[model samples]
Target: MKEKWRLLITEKNSAYRNMAMDRAELVSISKGNTPPTVRFFTWKPRAISIGYFQSLEDEVNLDACKNLGVDYVRRITGGGAVFHDKELTYSIVIPESHSQVSKNIMESYGRICGAIIKGLKQLEIDSSYIPINDIIADGKKISGNAQTRKAKTVLQHGTILMDVDVEEMFSLLLVPNEKIRDKMISDVKQRVTSIKHILGKDISFNQIADAMRIGFEEEFNIELNKGILTDEEIELTNKFEKEFFSTKEWNHRR
Candidate 1:
């Protein structure tokens, strides 16, 4: 008795386009206008996404991001800052009526983390779930997820590190002082490790994507329909692209 799913795969999209599409998918699914969607996307030119409630002037070094030519956007979900390089990003949008859907944040997080844990297990990583949203292997985080539930739909998305540039991640995120930055670097070093770093080999992006697809399908017992965004989603995405995701005000709001 597996729930069926539809997929949306956008290999390389601009930061603006990616965010816009996610928003549109959320609305479409919430309204029961679209099926559950799983999307894989990567930002072209790379970027840093701030959490929705985060303050731009306070949480990021805009000047450094600009100097580095890193585009910036604020996500509709809540989470800490993340560097989106060498990572495969997934966005899952489910209708509120889905039996597997969770209104409680922790419940939803656990299910998704369970899926991620299973995915990493395929790579022989022996991963497990950590509270407050993470997939950990050997006590180090490999994935981080965030979610937004509104008007009867849920949009959950996260990052899986294929490789990490530790120094660059620390540089882009704003820290009150050098001491905090140093401490954070140490903390991330202690707490996070990429799959490539742990495996001592590079895993193809497709391999990870398949792992995720299988994990989620097993967890939800759903027959996923491998596909892309519909014409309706595309039309709505185009509208969102101009109205919300690319705006400066949206990027900076607390």
Candidate 2:
């Protein structure tokens, strides 16, 4: 018998809501109140999300985000700042006791990212996982991922770039040295790419989601049952959104 997992595919939402929902799911699963889940979501009005340990002032330009009407939030996971636009974002939450999850962070990352690698292959993108975390194609990064373990559950989330606008992304983010900003941008352009660029065409969000769904099922030997969030998750998400993600006390807490 195949194991069963919950699958949530959500519509585009504000950055705060998305972050809150991801956290809520992690908490629910960790506490044994909900089943392990795979969530797919998108950003509305665009957004920039920085890692938990990142400094808002040092890593992002608040003025740029505000002036551009872009939402910004801090993720519970650790990684560099990422501009979330024109991408497919997915998160996985599983209890630590799950037989498939590795206690070692690097091994866990590899195991989890296998789904992404398989998904990219299904799309014919020819992607590979770079040790630690990251998915690359044609020697350029096409996906960025981050993970956190808390309350006995592991939450791993990431963005699969459907398209990239390096210039626009740079405008909203900061570099340590202003003098080297241009160089950094150039370097990133050479090292990062997107699905559209790789395939020379546009792909719909549903198509990407479908590929990832199949990837996860194949990698884990499980069947995903499409599910709606429980009432508890919804309530928790709202509370977190209002009390934490939407407040500077949390987003800028670094």
Candidate 3:
């Protein structure tokens, strides 16, 4: 018999709620109140999530986000800023001491990303994991991941692009100089790709999620029993959202 883990297919939510839920799951799993979990989610109204070490004002164009009715928040994990749109974001929460996770950060990244690479393969896209947390396909990046460990638990979350809009993304991010904006956008377009771009047609989020579910299961050698957040997790998410992720103090703490 395979060890069973929880799977959460959550509804699309605001950036605050999404980050809060990720943290909440981490906390709960750390406390042994819930099984190790894998969650699939998306951002509603779209959003920009900057790494924990990033300065929100420096990384994001707040005026553009506001004008476009998009949300923005800071994540607990460390990575570059990301525009959360037309993507399926998945997160895994498990004990850091678990046999499957490595003590070395780089090794852990490759181990976890192997699951993502397998997931992309399910979509019929050939992909490889690049060191330090990126998945590339056909010489272009198709996924980017970030990880952070806390309270003896590991939380890794990443985005798999279903479609991409480089122009829209660049518009919401800051550029060092207006003169280089066009060139930077052009460079990114050459480097980043999506399922639609690769397969020559759009793939639904559900389809991608299904593929990822199998990918993780196959890579981890565990059964993922579809599940929901516990009441404790919901309460924690609400608290975290109100007191942390949604607050200016947390988002602007840089």
Candidate 4:
């Protein structure tokens, strides 16, 4: 049985708003109310958000974040800390019962990466899909994804680097200030490339968003209706934004 999918465009880039959307995704998909959804979102003022199991205190510089006015939030998914610098972030929520597909994490990751690989191909980049959630080109990664499963739904999110400030990103995070970390940073540089770097020009955000939408539809061979969040989702999102995502306890909790 093929399930319908929805394409949703988010309004703003606040960490608070994105976090609310995560909760909304869980609720809607768990209830089988909303179709599987793909949402395009960005963060305002260049935020640095961590995974739910991670502690910002273990990764981010609190004083620098406060001084530079960078907001922070913890995601419901598991992964390392990510510095969201006005990058293109996408979230997909799907029910667990999708057939002829994946129950394995790596298999599911490949399915999601397929669309992204196609999208990158449009740019003549010849990107290759990598396992465990990454798209690599010329042995360098341009995209990384993470997933979390609810009772009957799964939520996966990832980032597409437009123009990552590598130095600033490494500086902001708590990397070991040792020679080994320096070598590791060099290794990372060898394995990562951004769209802006690859194209040698700036592509508008809307252009990339549109490409992703088209790519997904092409990959799945399904119709995707543009959709909106429900009122109940909005209410729960607001509560979550206030109670957890926007708080110091969450950002700093280990």
Give the winner by TM-score: 3
Candidate 2 lDDT by residue in tens digits, 1-254: 99999999986999999999999998899889987899999999799999999998889999999999999999889899999999999999999999988889898898888998888888997988897689999999999999999988999999999999999999999988899989999999999999999999999999999999988888888998999999999999999999999999998898
Give the TM-score of each candidate: 0.96, 0.98, 0.99, 0.92
Off by over 4 Å in 3: none
lDDT of each: 0.84, 0.93, 0.94, 0.79
Model 4: residue 9 alpha-carbon error in angstroms: 1.1
What's model 1's overall lDDT?
A: 0.84
List clashing residue pairs in candidate 1: 2-221
TM-score attained by model 1: 0.96
Alpha-carbon lDDT of model 4 = 0.79
Error of 1 at 62 (Å): 1.1
lDDT of 2: 0.93
3 or 4, greater by lDDT: 3
lDDT of 3 at 78: 99
Better of 1 and 3 by lDDT: 3
Can you write out model 4's per-residue Cα lDDT over 48-127, one digit (the tens) per residue? 87878987777888778878888877888888788888468888888778762488877888888887777777666778
Candidate 3 minimal-lDDT segment of 10 residues: 103-112
In candidate 4, how many Å is residue 142 off? Answer: 0.4
